[model samples]
Target chain A: MSQYSEDSGYVVAVDVGGTSMKGGVVTRSGEVVATDRRPTGAEGGPENVVAAIRSFVGDLAARGSSLLGRAPAAVGIAVPGLVDDATATALYAANLGWRDVPATGLVPLDVPVLLGHDVRTGGLAESVLGAGRELTDFLFLPIGTGIAGAMIIKGGPYGGTSGWAGEIGHIPVFPEGERCACGQTGCLETYASAAAVARRYSARAASPATAERVAALTAAGDPVAVKVWDDAVEALSLALATYTLLLDPSAIVLGGGLAEAGPLLSDPLAARLGERLTFRSAPPLRKAALGVSAGMLGAALLGWRAAGVPDARASWALDVPKTSAVP
Target chain B: MSQYSEDSGYVVAVDVGGTSMKGGVVTRSGEVVATDRRPTGAEGGPENVVAAIRSFVGDLAARGSSLLGRAPAAVGIAVPGLVDDATATALYAANLGWRDVPATGLVPLDVPVLLGHDVRTGGLAESVLGAGRELTDFLFLPIGTGIAGAMIIKGGPYGGTSGWAGEIGHIPVFPEGERCACGQTGCLETYASAAAVARRYSARAASPATAERVAALTAAGDPVAVKVWDDAVEALSLALATYTLLLDPSAIVLGGGLAEAGPLLSDPLAARLGERLTFRSAPPLRKAALGVSAGMLGAALLGWRAAGVPDARASWALDVPKTSAVP
Candidate 1:
């Protein structure tokens, strides 16, 4: 823990979700200190979301200054959408109902503020500090409310030619299978996301129970739960197999909510990927280590870099706020 | 012709096919001169192939020296195999039965000799000079005896993370389709390649005279030929659509023998791709302008670049060898 305070420059990392906004004072080594959260206020409009973020940042800064006696060097924010990192613009966010949100300018920080897609930022975190630390090439699949991914190539994330490189979720996995929110039919996300798993369980058993209970019942040999789990595993495996063939990543880092299922997901997914791969070496499937904090940690790293810190290694020098008393 | 001579230096480009070896003295501007050809003598082994290539080069050098009043600056060879341009090693050549053939060392020329894959070399020519010249991001899909492609990204070719990036033919188009020579089943090459089309026509029609006649009959509305043609187009379209979704190239340049079908191929492919692509912009389907000489032109450009020539711009130089001279 003493290693956490070696460098004392503040960087604000914010995770903007559909329902909530999470902000934190992240150390250079990816440790989060003085964290705060608030409702996204997205239903109220873009201005409300911006206000919430501003307040969150203000609160975080005040806490940091009171504790550490200095202001943050930069801020990094991660949001769910088609982010044009080159232009510092959120091109579109279907879930948040925001279009062309100039997030970089909206953040009330004199310091440099960097913006990136939520999944990509999570992938960056994985690449720098988690299972993908040593991998020069890998794919980060965040299986949450919606399945989307980011392609990590030679230690850098590929945003595609149009900042839409890792839209693998929208790729047609089962043609003519199911309608997706992206207006596509049979997308990989429709079958493999956590939402998909819960939907599958509900549709099969007509159960009103939470997905957590479904996981429990499936563990105890509930037939409908078992079927849903199996289908989710199969769908995930198919998508993974396709990714393996395309990018041939060193590994597939599974993150987000559904990955919490652990062996229930990894075991069957590994087996299915093995069955499909013939000519090439099948990549090892691993669970993401960072959990929910990945986005924050990644955003912090991005913020540090944006502040001219250079690389992920430099992120370790971030200043931690020294509070008079532990919060 | 005078401008071609002034713009390009004397360089020799060789296209090493399974059955034949074609060599030509190409100017820096992509014009061919003192062109020569000889049988590959593949059965005589790597040693014999080297001897044959040397003899061909010797003949071409003598003619080019006399014609241009100097020996060519460098030589570029395009072969059918996995070529490592960095190491100047041909990793594998199934048709030539050569593994790790160091053709660069084998060449007796004092000038630099650069080696590259035929399809990739062809793609380079197309991207720099042909239909894809204006597009920074595109895919060059050449469907000859076999189907393969080269991805052009940001004005450069991506040799995959493992230098095997352009094996688009091996990508499974139909999971339950026919077995391919590469040990995969239902590859696009099995149905879409020129050889596949000819084989399908020969097998089904039984009374086929030649591939040309079959093509003519197909154009004349023969039922058997039409079926084979339609299936070939469908397979090619599916492959193209998959590529469009994956890379989202600006254009899909159709080369090789089947591309000779012109509108017969492009119109249907465009329609299929348009139907498949929902959110993304549909890339234009166009014919490769360089034709057979595309390989030679690419080889020459590679040689020029390898030789450290200051102003290597072979693609833009209008020195195309007439089609009638080769095909």
Candidate 2:
């Protein structure tokens, strides 16, 4: 917990989501000395959310300073939607209702700041410290309220062309299946997202239930729940198979709420994904190690990078090893 | 016809396909000083094909030696297989019936040699000299007897974790549709390959017709031909949409015999692709500029790369001039 100058050695790491944001004060040696969460005030619109985030960063830095006696060396942030990492700006996030919000606007501190796309930042954490530790190329797929993937190519997250890459949620997995909220037809997210799974099951079942309840009900052989779960699995199988063929990922790291169902989801999903690939074997699916904290940890890595300590995570060797222990 | 030296400026280039192989002697300045073609001898077995390639390469080098007053400086071969470029070995090609064939086995000359996968090598050519010029990321789709793609990422072709990255044609576009020869159901290849287009049209129409003839008939308003063509276009739209959503490529370059239909193919594909992508504009569909010569030219680039001249193609302006090109 004590490395460098203790307080001054840590960085303020934040993961900003549409509904809420998670913040932490993390040391260079991969220790989270202080952590907190707060509502993003998104209901009050983009400016309110920005003010909340800036206040949160200030509070975290002040807490760290009190704990160890100095200001944080740098700040790292993860935000939803399009990000221009080169300029450290949040280009656009439809859900956040913001465009071109510079990283400077999100932090009250005067230290070096860096930004990353929310999903890709989580992918970076998974790549550096979690399920994908051994992989140079893989897909980090987080399935929760919505689905998106971070394509880890040549050991880093790849945001193609205009930073719009990894919109896997919007891809049409079942071409004639259903309409998505984004106005696309037969999207994978329409059936496979945790929110979608619960929504779909509730629309057909006798009672409304969470995705967790749906998983348990399906496992207990409830026919309606089973049908809904099977559709999600089928949709995922198609999308995963397509990803495998196109990217040939070493493995797929699954995280977020849907994955907490554990083997109940992985077992059938794995079998179906294998069956779909005719010429090549299916890439193994591994559970994410960092879970919901991946983005925050990844921001810590970005913070470390900003502080000119690239090997800090490497030296710590926390959580998982190069030969990942996620299983 | 020459740049480095009049006596030794050229390299031997070969594009080895399942049925035939194209060979060329290309100078550093990007001129094909001589060219030839021959059977791959695949039916006679892998050894026969290897021996045939060696003889063909020797003959091309001899021709270049007489023309340039010296032996070629390097060799580049594009094979239809999984290639370990780092080791210069062709690992496997089901069609070519080869395994563990070293690049040296096909090149009698002692100069440096490099091997690349057929599709990716062609994509490299497209990236450096053809339709994908000036673009850092794009998909080069060639709809021939079969379908495959070259995913040009970061100004070069990207082969995935195990050199199988761009198998775009095998993606399941229609989940419950026709089974493919690869034993996968609803593959883009099953519905959209030139052979598939010709075969489907022939099966439904009174008379048999080639894919080129089918394209002509579709243009002339033949219902059967139009149906087959439409299915191909629809399959293509779905695959491209999926690709765009996943990779966000700048453009998609269409090549091969079917692409010669020009507006007959691109017009409907562009419209349908745009319709499929609700949030993002569809990437423009461009015609592949180099045609059948793409693979051979890519092999030349590989040859120059093997000879330690990475910028040989950049030295010559083929399409849109690179900003670094000399005045």
Candidate 3:
């Protein structure tokens, strides 16, 4: 609902995933002025992916200037990997097959450039604009392909010393029970992540089905689906209970694909987490409202922050976008 | 060696433990001008303990006034419990058998008073004067009769909402492996706490021996002691590794009674934690340098802050106290 006028400046924001690159031109008030996308070309090699990102940013910049009558004041990029936000460098990304790439330096723009991890960026967006609004302390957990967390402490995203603070997925929930791709045992992601649920269900059911289908099947009283779904809920709740004992957040916002299951996910998770916690009470578990566009919006907010705009005016406090992508 | 002149000012600081109450009259530079101790009288129940604390603080205030040639500027009390640091209220202390006691109100003093949890206060002291000095991000784990942690973030103590942020002791390490007194299963404290080590050793050896004696026995090649010590180290390392994956602390400072085991505790712990970590490197494990007086010193620091004094003048950067009690 935010409108951009002639005087309103713009920021270019991009969110790079394993398969696609999402880019947007956003006004100061967080309105999407223009948008674009491109295939990551990841399978082609790291150089191809890097080149694609450069072309995407260039296109967005040109489109932004034409739409806003001026070039963007700043650019913000979010990538899925071990990103060092302080230096705007992608330290390492296994899926992207890149390391030590200075992402901010790759963009040949006149404005300031900022870079951050994809999950943290999405959490920041949700915290400021979606379900987490008005809460200063909470955890934004995105149960996507692999589980990750964005810790919102004192009203802002908290990246640990090595920019790897919210690796909640890697926390051993089963204690040497199952091996993880990260060379760890019993990681929460190994059992509870959306990809894990689908893969495990498919292996047992002898047919490939998305996590969404598994949830539907469980609701319809499918025995195998029920077992798999119950296990995921139990693992998630246990990990959350442990986190509650450590940080004691005010609430936990469940985002990403798995959370889209709505009551099916929240209901069982609440009951299990409540049972696990004895002394300390379990925090409210709310679903994220921003959907998939959260990463792009969060990147835009960071762009405004890089342009020295205050957080209050920089964030999107408007209603959630109805479309799957940024409006 | 900070010399207390008549005009320099002083504060009364108390650290109330399960067995004894340690009180001190501290100068501006963390020097203990006078000190006293009293039995907690816990067997007489909560009211008796409260009365003892009142008498101890009143006596310390009188002694401090006489020693400094003026009344103390502030008072700081550190107790083992669920404390509401903002309101100076002791919410609950299982050891002290008190709940919802307004400790500051009981002081009946004109000076500002501050109350905090014992572990967090020790962490604050370590952050300013000991191993954690100059580090903004770290975890302070004290393996005493019960395990607790003080999380130092952004160069200051972090007391979570309701002042229960660092209850790492209660985190289910074994997940239904052992029964803890708190009615939990396989808690980190159940296996790794100093009291647990001593009690387990005493139970199995059929002769009473403290955790210190068990360490000595392990060094002398006692099979039982070696097994018990190895299990303790494994449990502690597992819990610490999980914490590292979550918080990514720069270092972990081990304090309290068990840390007195020195290399026998740290060396094995460091190696085990390093082996457990895959993507992220293990943080350095360091023994607490402030000894048992960390609580008293930290309380004094809080007293100075409460009295509106600058930190440079309030810190004990001069010398390490050699005496068992505060010097």
Clashing pairs in 1: A8-A319, A9-A319, A28-A315, A28-A316, A28-A318, B8-B28, B9-B28
| Interface quality of candidate 1 as DockQ | 0.31
lDDT minimum window of 10 residues, candidate 2 chain A: A318-327
Which of the two candidates, 2 or 3, achieves a greater lDDT against the reference?
2
Clashes of each: 7, 0, 0
Q: Rank the candidates by lDDT, best first.
A: 2, 3, 1
Q: What is the lDDT of residue B8 in candidate 3?
A: 67
Candidate 1: deviation at residue A303, Å?
Answer: 1.7
**Candidate 3 C-alpha lDDT tens digits along A1-327:** 223576578888999999998899888766786777789999998888888888888899998887777788988888888987667788899899999898665587768888878988988888888778888878999998999899888788888778878888988777857798998888889889999899889988999999999999999999989988987897798688878888888899999899989999999999888877777788999988888888988888888878888573434436535433654
lDDT of 2 by residue, A56-78 (tens): 99999998888767889889999
Relative to the true structure, how large is the alpha-carbon lDDT of every model? Answer: 0.75, 0.89, 0.84
Candidate with the larger TM-score of 2 and 3: 2
Q: What is the TM-score of chain A alone in each candidate?
A: 0.92, 0.95, 0.95
Compare the candidates by lDDT and give the number of the best one. 2
For residues A183-288, what per-residue lDDT tens digits would candidate 1 score against the true structure? 7666778877778878878888876665566778888999998887877776676566666665657789998888888887788889878876666667899888
* Model 2 ranges with Cα > 4 A deviation: A1-8, A320-327, B1-8, B319-327
Residue A185 of model 3: what lDDT?
Answer: 85
Model 3, position B221: C-alpha lDDT score: 86
Docking class of 3: medium
